[model samples]
Target chain A: MDSYASTRLTRIRTAMKDQGLGGLLVCANGMRRDHVRYVTNLNVLGSWAIAVLGPERGPALFIEDPWDLDRARRDSWAESVTAGPGLLDGIVRAAGELGLRGPVGVAGMELMEAGLVLALRERLAPLTLQPATRLLVELRLLKDEGELRAIRRASELADAGYEVFLGTARAGLPEYELVAEIEGFLRDAGAEDNMMILASGGVEVTGMRPPTSKRLQVGDLVTAELTPQVNGYYAQICRTLVIGEPSAAQQQSFEIFWQAQEAAMESARPGVTISQVAEAQNEVFRKAGFGEYVSKRYTRARGHGLGLHFDDEPLIWEGNDLRLQAGMVLIAHPNTYLPLAGYMVLGDPLVITDGGCERLTKTERRLFAVAP
Target chain B: MKRGLVEWDRQELPEGAFAARLAACRAGMCEERLDALLVYTDVWRAGHVRFLSHYLPYWSSGLLVLPLEGEPLLLSTQPQRVFPWIAETSLLREVRAAPALGKAAAAVLAERGWRRAGVVELQELPWGIYADLTAEAPGACELVDASALMRGVRLSEDGHEEALLTKAAAMAAAPLAALDPVGQRDWAVIATLERAYRRAGAEDLMLLVTSPTAGQWPGVPREAVLADGVLLQASLEYKGHWLQLSRTWLPAGASPLRGLYDRLGRAYAELSETARPGLSEAEAAGLLKRLAPGDGLHLFAAHASGSAPFTPLPGLDGIEEGMVVALHLGAEDRQGHRALVGDTFLARREGLARVTT
Candidate 1:
């Protein structure tokens, strides 16, 4: 096995032993696939998959789609790979074969199908099943060299995507079409996936969303959060641009968001709580007299972690006391609605270092302008 | 997940279309003796809710509460700040920002005094949501699995659905038709298709590329250069509708799989010809066996398409009018020669019509 896989396996087995778990069942679908990918190194497609890892034996991978069997065998590092017309049956058989006699930990128990969980509980008999999602999260919280490399590549792609966005944003261009151009560019540039949301308007716009049919007009403020994933690692860059020469109010709004994002990024270092980072950003907004927008009423998170999953842990929000550590990667975006210029987004992806955080995104932190 | 163009085009799917869908769902609820129906939706599975409310969730999850009498309500996990956008894009007039979907849905049931709530695809509902729903609800409220009921209601396509499927099929096929895999890397080929699909406004895509030299099984396209004997499978969603198309490409030079490709083509023709209304999935498999016989063929998937919860063939139901089906057939010989062909088809009253032509 590769060193990466070996290290990960050792960590997982140690964790399992600590919890007195005989086995770890990691469940994943197209949406919640980070845990399974972390274990098996197979990017799951189709409905769902389960990775059965026991302390004594190598992991066994079971996928829902039969057509994906050959690929799973070829791609996954699991000792045995199985696919199904009957996925639950395969998972149960594999679990039994692995000799999981004690309580087993399931990483994605809450996301699994209700009937599947009930059936597993009934079939597994006295072997208890425990929720272990937090365990996986804790294990993946730190970034390794290989993961950081992939995130860095994804950050480069995100920058390229924004360049395309800037070039494509013009008057009479529909928001969806503009997004289409950016997506095409990113995909061609080797991005496996991109989670992007954009909006174009002025004071009427509340926040960014999936591309709409609305056409961009002169002086419109177009904000986009472009997150591109490469090799299962996602990096995000949120920026706002104007179709024409920006008004004084738009530039003023942009300053607030830029300052807030800078503050948040500056506060993001090892030993600092995520809440502190969020408060740092919110404090800027409060000082600017737009403190009301800091709540959930006007925004979601000041920033959040980005990794295998687009939205990972350490969500930079109030009440989240998770402390930042070296090797943790996150995006500090003070994205919210500003009554002066509608909504603005200014953020950059960064990795917390031993002393401080280093910004991964090299895009200039300013409101870009395009000719009408 | 689906970060592509997600706007609801009223011209394509008008408010009346959603009204008709909601009406049909309410009619189904009445037939099932359900006081309300709850459809769970996330980024991966948003079809049922999208069909009823034109609300395709971009992230997180949500619950659609359709009472037997009143207009349907959408409880989204997205922040309230985006509720105005959801309301503007969807037919839902009532969009609540409920991070805890089950608790909110239970409250809705309690407020409506619903006694029997049918949860579509109840088995697939996340355990947390299911547990919360059952725990927080009134003591007398009953939740039953209504997967089959929703499937039965959605099995047949309406005019708007058929139109969307047709457009999606064309969009999926155009890029493949224009692809030239010779001497090109797999990633480049995928990039070409991705560019085309996104340019055409595909909401989502699932693409796989396979070659004999690279591997026998279709996998996510990688950076290996392609030579001959390539298979491309593209399944894309456009405007909430899905269509799949698979094609095999061979160089003009002599290849061992030439004859096999011809045979696969003939087999696909026979399968499409025999796929008529009322033909059971078992019957379809039987006909496939008759066409290929012995170990000459391998069936990948033959199933209903055009929406979520794509029911595979050899299922409980037969081919029905207005149902779109995707059939994929593959063949391989001892010498490692292989060929595969597949397409999406629409079942009409008269016969089957290929949608991915």
Candidate 2:
């Protein structure tokens, strides 16, 4: 096993021992399978997969599709990989063979249909099933050396997407076409996936989404939340660009958001609560007399954690008391709505260090303008 | 990757279309003596809800509580955050935030006095919520499986849906027309094709690449150099409809696999020829076994397409007029030669029509 995998397994085992859990059941279906990916480095893609990690038996991978059997064996660190007609039966058999007793920790239970979980509970009677959501989140909160490298690569891809945006965002092209260009560039650069929402129109644009066929006009403001995943690690960078010279109102709104982002990033040091980072940015809007727009309706979280998942944990929102720790990666974005300029986005990923935070992305924070 | 509950279209579907779908669903519920229909959706499978209402679920699990007499209610964990998104994407008027979906659904049943309710994919529901719902309703409500009802109702496509599928298929195939495939990495080719499809209005695109060098049927793309011969599978989802096609790339000088491609093409043609509206599942399976060269583990040779692909597998009831199905034929030899060719087809009384040329 690689050093990273060894270290992560050790950490997970330690946590499992502390919680008095004999075996951990990690189930991943169509969505939110980060726990399985975190432990096994295996992606089920469109199907469902489960991993059973035991104190004595090590790891065994279970999948529904036969095609994934080869993939799991080839890509995963699991000692044994199982796939066939009776997948659920295989899961039950594996649990028994692993000799799991007492209460078992289950992750990704929220996404599992209630019927499946109930059935599993009935079949695996005498063993209690408890939510290990907190346990998994705690394990993935810190960024290790390998994870840091992957995040850095993902952030670089986001920057490359921005460069594509700068080159392609112009008048006459449809907004979706620009999406194609930006995502195409990132994908070509080895990005596994992209979560992008782009909106381009006059100053009064309402929101962002997957690019529509709406044609861009001169002086339109384009705001995009470019998030690209590299090796399952996601990094997001939000930027707003003008088709031509920005209006005075647009420039003013940009200045306020830029200052807010800076303030938010400045307070992202270790030992500080994430709410403080949010307060610093929200304070900017309040002082500028735009405090009413700081609500959730007008904006998403000021920023959130970035790692295996796009929006991880410790939401940087007002009054949240989750303290910052060294090795926690966050995106300090104060992407909010403005009456003058509508919705504008600007932010970058940062790594919390002993004294301060290190910016993961090197893209410029200025209000970009594309010449007509 | 799993599908997400996010609308790629900035505009909502026509109000009349949504109304027609709801009317069809209500008719189904009425036929089964169900007072209300509960459609469960998540990030992975949001098609049923998206069919009745254009709104897509995001982050948390979602449910559409459609009563026989009253307006439909959308239950979500974060109604406020999802309100504008739903408003922008759907025609539904009522939405409620419910932390506990089962209790919330039970309450809806209680409020409407819905004694006979139907739940689609009941087995997929979480046990905890199922327990809470049963506890809350006790003997007041009886839940029946509505999966068949929903599937039968949506098996055939309307005119608008057919047009959307055709357009989506064209968009997905546009990138292949320009791909030379030589001297390029798998990632580069996928990236290029994904860009073209997404820009042309594909909400989600799934690409699988394989080659003779790789013994696997569907191979993951990496930094490996492209082989002289390769098979590319592209599946595109647009406007809640799915379109899938596979293309084989070969150089002009290659004649060794000419017979293989010819046989694969004939298999597709033969399947299309025999796929009539009234064809039984057993008859279709027999025809495939008699004509096809390779074995299909689950009869994936020709499967129905929708929000998800090849769902409900292919049964006697699955074949119908105006049904859109994907024809994916795979052949292999003991010598490790593998070939797969697939595209979307429109089933007609006469025969079949290829939607993605």
Candidate 3:
């Protein structure tokens, strides 16, 4: 529960040793560099690095870009460090520094283009270039306490933003104003940077999209799916609220959706098949004659993992074959549209627990009615 | 803006270039023996869509019904009775009302009486379509990942595309260099880039701003302080074009940092000179790393293009002639000192041309 970088690195090194690999090459730039920060604690803006592990050397960080060297070393979990450019050459140099030559297992080596692969092989002709896939992403599928905290913080920010909307948003208010308020609040609150899109559900059907200057109309469903990234961890919190008095059909739709969400959440637990959670939720809708409507209109998974990436996997869907594991943070929503009702959505963030799941989002998951 | 690169311009892709790419799509589909090649265009672009359709949809989503046989139709889901966006694109046959978008794809296909097809851009195609397309179609419409075709076509940037990126990089770099350090150790560079993007007429903006200090963040903007000699890698996204650039500012008089910076500048040029055309990216990356100073000196190893804060490059990139790249070169020590010099260039046979210049 005491999340530490070195401890994970040890587990990773053990995996590397089992694979008989010398080093794992990881690249980062722009937004995708979350993995680097997750590992080394250094955000290499425009750099590439390969983390090498030899039986004798333990672990080392070989980075190319100069800007992050001091920071990478200062922040890195590993003590063995070197800076240089050519990936294979840098790895080779790190390999040489550790006196590891003959055969070194490489993770990103197989991902190289045919030409680059040939060139690398030619350069390190005698050394064995074993194939190893990038396993760092999979390692992140499950979250520890520290990771959960970051996600929880992100979810709390989303909750605050929702509360702000609930208090301020109303019919006749332009969509962008609501969007701007949420983004401005998040930025000021010092949350992990954010990029999100919003949709004002008046336009026939609206998926979460960038806020236009579209004014909210009476009976409009204002849907907002905003993901504010926290140190590379992404939390997708989507909430739909009625602008004014909802139509009877719309209110009815919300009730059915509210029940479906409950069924799904109650079924989701550690070791449970993701499919079971999905089925349970769909069953609630199925009994209500909304089963066929869900399939036709509800086009996304019931829930997905929130932290690290948009990794809504071990996906809770009909055919999804992934099992939920403890500490896995997920967002669940049961949303669909019947011809009579325009749209319906119910969302909540949950953490997989020992027996079942813990609801992370404290928001009232229902049709948040707003008076114009 | 940095050391080299002063000349820059956005030379638009030729009028016929879009048509040619579409023709290439048709040819590719025929070769793959796939039915129809479904392409997409949207605001949250993957960047490859513009290479073929020539129309950059500024809305949430757009779809291209690129049949191996007929003229491609650009189905925009921006809710218009009239296709107002048709003027910007070279794509013909615009369908305005996609009332039931998920179901429309199959209806359109059935109306055309098409059976086998390949869908490109899997990321944009939602799960609903995956279910609808398979269920509604008469038989399995042999969907292939048309994205590979996109990657293959995008092996190198054309001269016109090169020009756009160059202008973006050059225009983006100047203001950043001239920027005064704000009060905080951390400042928002992406916000500044957006201002620069508007100054340079960039239709959409997505740039990377990274600082060694505590404040810089990715995608969205964040505040970070820029001390003397902090090397910032600012990858500018403009008018849907991407440009990679880096600069080191030595606030007036910082000698050792400046000296180390000068050394890196020389090394970058030297690396450029030696970077042969068609050099495998790994070879080119290796060449750059080998030049990185030994003990007393330091530098960022390097990646292929300056277009960062992140990329999917297995390493840097294979340096090819006529291809544009940002060779990142910078160094910082434990003293909170950093200097960076990055130049965008077009690889030539023996030498490289600084595209921004």
Candidate 4:
């Protein structure tokens, strides 16, 4: 195993021991893979996968799709890998073989299929099953050097995707077609996956959604959150642009978002609560007499942690008490509705440092304008 | 994950089709004595809900509540601000932003006084959602598995669905047909294909590459020089329908595996020819065994395909008309040389018609 995998395994094993778990069954799917990836370093592609890790023996990876067996064996750090017609059955058999008769923790249990969980409980018998989703989340709360490298690369790709978006957004272009251009560029540039959502309109647009057939018109505020994943790590960059020259109202509305994002990022330091960071952003809107827009009625999170999953821990929102720690990676975006000019987004991916935070996204924090 | 084009084509999938689908689902619910049927959708398994509502979530999850005799409602994790877009893109008029999908669904059931509720793919429902739902209602509601009912409803494709599948198959085959893997890097080839798929408006895709001789399993593209005897398997979704196609690339020369490739092609042809509406699973397996009778053959041969979460051919009784299936045939020779070929086919009364050529 590489140093990165070795370090991760060591940490996971230590956590398992501390939790009084005899074994760990890490589950993942295409949608939620951080748990399994953190345990086995495998990028799952099938419907679902499970990594059976014991105290004495190494981890054994099991995937549902037989076609994915070879890939899982090749990519995963686990010594024993099996592809199955029945993923849960394979997990049960592996657990028995590993002699795990005590309480076994199953990460991502909440996200797992209910029937499978029930079957596992019945089959495992005396071996109790425990929910370990929080355990995995706490382990992945901080970014290590290897993870930082991947996140930095993903941030770079997000920047490149934004450039592609800026170059492709034009009047008369369909929203889907514009997304296609950005996706193509990102894939060609070595991004395996991206979570992108865009919206193009004037004040009528409330927020970004999956690309639609609506055509971009002049003076439309095209907003997008371009998050690209590289090496199983994700970084995001949210920005808004105008198809034509920005209007005075659009510019004025965008400045507030920029300021809010800046304040949030500045407040993102070690020992600061995520709610404080979110309050900093909301305070900007409050000073501008748009405080209501910061609530859930008009917007979601001010920002969120970006990692293997698009929305990770320390989600920057009011009332979230998770503290910012050094080595934690997150994005602080003041993306919300502006009465003067639709929803505007201006955010950057940054990593919390000992003193403050370091910005990973190099995109200029401003309202970009594409020539009509 | 599906960052590519994701727009509802009103002309391709009209409102009438969604209405028909909802009506069919309600008909099934009525027959099953179900007050309401719930279809959960996420990025990975959105076929059931998308089929009935044309609402494929970009992220998070959603629930489609189909009452026996009322307008269907959609509860999504997306905020209410994006409901207008959801309404515009889908046939759903009542779209509620439910952060907790199961809780919201449970509340909806309670509000409607629904007692007998059926959940499609009940086994696959997330444990958290299931707990929330069952906990919220306790013994007041009864949830039953409706996977078979849903499957029966989706087994036969409509004309519009077939057209979408045909288009998706063609799109999947386009890049493979144009690929020149000779002297090209593996990642470059994959990147080129991905670009093509996205440019053609694919919503999502899964591509794997393999070299049979190197004892390597089919895997995501890595940085390696591509040579002769490489296999590429691609499954791409257009709009909401999925189609799979596999091809083995070989340099033109006196290759040792030419005979194997030819034999595999013949087996695929024969399998396609023999697969009809009434073909039984045993008969299909027997035909495959006779065509490529050996211990080196891969166990997985065929599966029903048309939407996300393609069902394997084991639990299903047999092939039927209008059913789209993807057949894969692969075997290894005594010298360790291996060849695999596959194509998506549409089962008809006469015979199977190849959808991906």
- lDDT winner among the candidates? 1
lDDT by residue for model 1 (B1-357), tens: 676778778898889987877788878888889999999988877778887787878887899998898778888888888787787778888888888888999999899888999999888888889878988998878989988778777765688888888888878876776778867877778877877787788888877887854546567766677787688888888888877777889887898778778878888788778768776667765787787653367666545442353545543136677677777787776666567788887778777788888
The top-ranked prediction according to TM-score is: 1
Q: Candidate 4 regions off by >4 Å?
A: B138-140, B210-214, B276-282, B293-295, B299-307, B314-322, B333-338
Q: Which stretches of candidate 1 lie over 4 Å from their true place?
A: B276-285, B293-296, B302-311, B314-322, B348-351
Residue pairs with colliding backbones in model 2 are A113-B125, A113-B126, A114-B125, A114-B126, A114-B127, A115-B125
lDDT (tens digit, per residue) of candidate 2 on B1-357: 222223534334467877888888889999999998888766557677877787666445678898888799988765364476677667667988787988998888887777899988777766556667777863778988788778766764667677777777777767788888755788888888877777677767677776744665555576666665777888777877777787777656765666666777777677666777777767876887787555332234334433334443344336667667776666665555666677788887777788988
- CAPRI class assigned to model 2: acceptable
lDDT of 4 by residue, A175-212 (tens): 87788777767766777778888888989888887776
Please state the Cα-based DockQ of model 4 relative to the true two-chain complex.
0.59
lDDT at residue B307 of model 3 (Cα atoms):
20
Provide the TM-score of chain B versus the true chain B for each model in turn. 0.92, 0.88, 0.74, 0.92
lDDT score, candidate 3, position B102:
44
Q: How would you order the candidates by TM-score, starting with the best?
A: 1, 4, 2, 3
DockQ of each: 0.66, 0.43, 0.08, 0.59
Which prediction has the highest DockQ against the true structure? 1
